[model samples]
Target: MNLTIDEIQDFKGKYPKQIWSLFFSEMWERFCFYGMRGMLVFFMISQLNFHEKEANLQYGATQAFVYAFTFVGGLFADKILGFRKSLFWGGLLMIVGSLILATNPHDFFFLGIAFTVVGTGFFKPNISSMVGQLYKPNDSRADAGFSLFYAGINLGALLGGYLCIAIGKGEIFSSIISESMRWNVAFGLAAFVMVISLINFVFTQRSLGTIGLQPGHPESELQSAPMPKWKEYGVYILSLIFIPIIMKMVSVPEYTDYFMLTVGPLTLIYLFYEMSKVTAAERKKLWAALVFILFSILFWGIYEQSGGSLSIFAAKNLNKDLLGLDPNGVNNSGGAFFIIFLAPLLGLLWIWMSKRKIEPNTIIKFGLGFIFLGLGYYVLFATRLFADLQGITSLNFFTIALLVITLGELCLSPIGLSIMTKLSTKNLQGMMMGMWFLASAYGQYVAGIIGASLVSTNENASNYDALITYTEGYKQLAIYAIIAGVVLILISPLVKKLMQGVK
Candidate 1:
């Protein structure tokens, strides 16, 4: 399996570094993305004066829209701009958005969110798709390379949590910086990291060669056939300008759901159109992809609690002030520190298995992932027996819980991207990627809605009383998520067959 000098030289000057360079580029981008996400909900509730319930919903909507639009972005890249250009444009827009986000002025909040939505729309899916482009068909290194890419993402996320959020959290601990800089520090860091990402990609673009091409060029582009993708994306963008009006029309209590209602149909229509163009074998792949999509919703619905319920859990119950760390702190840092180390070890584990030709099938791995996730949460569920939910608990409980949760994340999150690439038909890869991201969108939306119940209050209740009422809701979700994971494992065999031997 060792690459010879002559073989390695073949790739030299022909696109000098493919996988690692893209890996680093995505790493920095996730740094900016995750850093901001770590602070978003608390920033809303604390700084903006949002009710706990209201802030969570808004956070949910913001996150959901960001991902849902990746559906548009994947199409846009596949059909129009190509991945490199789309990524560059997305990065540029995100820098601008970060500048807007760094400001504390109320006027900037919605504007920042708007810019970020469009920016992420162009960013998220295209980069991962390009990772698949790094390998030749059936190259065993493909999944391992993606695992490396996942490690890169966590590296950034871990840094963002420790360096970015913890730095901003300084206000809670010390008055060294004015309140003016407290919120801005995280955004400012995001801006700086993103600029580095932009520079890295701009310089490395030539090395990627034909990896992210649009649908049509020549037979040299891939097969001697025509291709198409972004028309649906264009329509989607056009539809986005009307979403405000549509949201108003629905008149639902939760405007976020109304918004999702509008976009959900568009996602379906796009999928239907993509499916119309594929063969039976490829279509079976799509069905398998559908099973992944369903399972993904379940997976992320619980895992995404890191940004919502679990985050709140850290603030209220966890020993936030442990070892002199402040309760109202920003970084939410240590958990990610464990992730930084664990992710790579897991990456190497996967690669080691691949080299031995002992790779687990995708669905089986997915099933195992759920068991790990359930195990992680049930640890917290066990803590309830020993610790009082009605009183403060030691942060050690949360730290241990997150460590286990991160292990579960290591199992599933990395592999999901690899699965998307394998399961896709060439014509529908972009669409399938978008659909995959949509599961995340829905999961965030659900997390937000669920988080609200965890802390929501009745109008008649005192604020303190309402908070107590809401935390109980979180307890229920903890139980619910644990149960859902088991059900997913039970159904794993059915999904494995639907995959038709893709693994």
Candidate 2:
């Protein structure tokens, strides 16, 4: 799968120019995605009258499906329609889903969520696969390229988060609309972003050249004909059938857990099957990829709380005033702004380190990710002592914790994207990319369980009660992160050997 010599020689700048198109497309897609995400739990608790635990469970179920479906979507892209077609189809479904939510906020919330889950399944993994496709095998720019893409995602997140709060709080829609109608405005904005993303991709996709074209079966008898229409339509019908099932799963926590339990082992079996087919060296690389994937579940389980527990804590406990903006919106924007400023520097740093042969290997980078995650939680944990001693949530301490977590994210997230492409065999690229997000699916499910456990049932609980709950959660998560980081570092040498020459 290595790019031919001319393609490799074409890397003349910090990034391939086509990445900007992908960047803006993903940015808007993320704008739509996170715009809804930033407000989901708040919307549930406020408008839908959901208890905190119920909200957490529901959030977990939805996020899990959003990611878990990527595996199915990836298979569709790899085996039937190619990446470009999948992305377009997925985008259309998402737009429809977002509009559904905006149009009937009370009646169709879960239904809207279902459309998004299926739509994202097809869209998210393949866009990432396309980013990897833009490079040749062993391309040094690959990690940096993914970092830039990751930054674009967060940039959308920052803007989307701001819009979510602005509209939700009646800051923008207050003049012409009542407070009750403001949320609809936010959801409508999310749909609008997706529309823009689809339009942009339609125009710029030719820049991708032949990267995602489908292949004909090599058998001479079948090579000339296209895939049968019924088969393609049958897959579409099968995918549609899952929407109701996922909608049901998200409505109940136990069902969601059971779904992941069933999916996790089946996915592992697929990986094992693939490993059996590869040569020994390639098998080792895949094993290393699995090791990272396993630990990533833990990393993401802790990291994903920002959308669930952490967001609640910010809205309830933290100082919200940042120049009259909603605190949750500001908090949500903080990490994205950090990513925008830091990503290019980090991307360039990777390039510089690659040139000097001093870049940290993937295992070590993952370990760093864990360490920072641990540190971020520990920082938040320390706020509990401050709350006990001074009765303050300490906005400064909360902001600092976010910054630390963003550092951990920088180390791991994009690196995961880069290494998956490097380690996977070309034919299995989409499947493996989906598997990577499947780890996130599991992580998000675990996050829900953890967040739900911390819900305060008492409506009038004092600040101390909330403090105790958050502190205990932060302390426990911090300890797990540190343990995972230490263990990964301990095994880095062996993992490095397994990586076989991949950096």
Q: Against the true structure, whose TM-score is highest? A: 2
| Distance from true location, Cα of 321 in model 2, Å | 4.4
Q: List lDDT for all candidates, in order.
A: 0.68, 0.83
Global CA lDDT computed for model 1: 0.68
Error of 1 at 145 (Å): 1.6
Cα lDDT tens digits, model 2, 117-225, are 8999988999898888777778889999999999988889899977876787676658987777787888888899999999999876766665555545332112445
Off-target runs (Cα >4 Å) in candidate 1 are 1-17, 171-176, 216-220, 223-253, 321-323, 326-335, 354-358, 383-390, 456-475
In model 2, the worst 10-residue window by lDDT is 215-224
- Model 1 TM-score, 2 decimals: 0.85
Clash count for each candidate, listed in order shown: 4, 0
Return the lDDT, model 2, position 209: 61
Q: Which candidate has the top score in lDDT?
A: 2
Listed in order, each prediction's TM-score against the native is 0.85, 0.94
- Tell me model 2's lDDT, rounded to 2 decimals: 0.83
Alpha carbon lDDT at 152, candidate 2: 80
